[model samples]
Target: MSKVTQHEATGLDDLDPATAPARDAVHFRRIVAARQQVSDAEDGLREAVQAAREAGDSWTIIGAAMDTTRQAAHERFGRAR
Candidate 1:
């Protein structure tokens, strides 16, 4: 039995330039899907932050969790409401 690597599992390593149009379409679709996923995750994070604040979590704690300063966290997320 042959071993299948991670690249083969994702089909990205199999893209051929000879099929440039089809390959480009597939890549574009993947990019769109990835962007949607990121947007969804950001929305979830915003909601979680709101809930955390309601539960008495501080900017200092949220900033630490995000690897940023308290002021930075506040600047990025505080105005969402």
Candidate 2:
């Protein structure tokens, strides 16, 4: 996938109010959809980790699935007291 430049990412909200509405509408829609996909992926990852813990899975196993160190996984997703 092509990378979004800092200008494109940060200047999305700086569009002119009097310009063509269709142009801004398309750009806004694309940004919203991209953000939604990210949110969904984060939710899915959290649910998967919770399910793993409930299944008595070890941090090492979960880390392997996520391609990270065991301690990293625990630090990232472990329950807080």
Highest TM-score: give the candidate number. Answer: 1
Candidate 1 residues 1-81, lDDT tens each?
Answer: 999997898897877878845534788789979999999999998998888889999999999988999999999899956
Runs of candidate 2 with Cα error greater than 4 angstroms are 1-22
Please give, for residues 1-81, the per-residue lDDT of candidate 2 as tens digits. Answer: 999887788885677768836444688789989999999999899999999999999999999999999999999999752
- The segments of candidate 1 whose C-alpha lies over 4 angstroms from its true place after superposition are 1-24
lDDT: worst 10-residue window of model 1: 17-26
State the weakest 10-residue window (summed lDDT) of model 2: 16-25
Residue 17, model 2, lDDT: 66
Give me the displacement of residue 10 in model 2, in angstroms. 9.6
- How far residue 33's Cα lies from its native spot in candidate 2, in Å, is 0.6
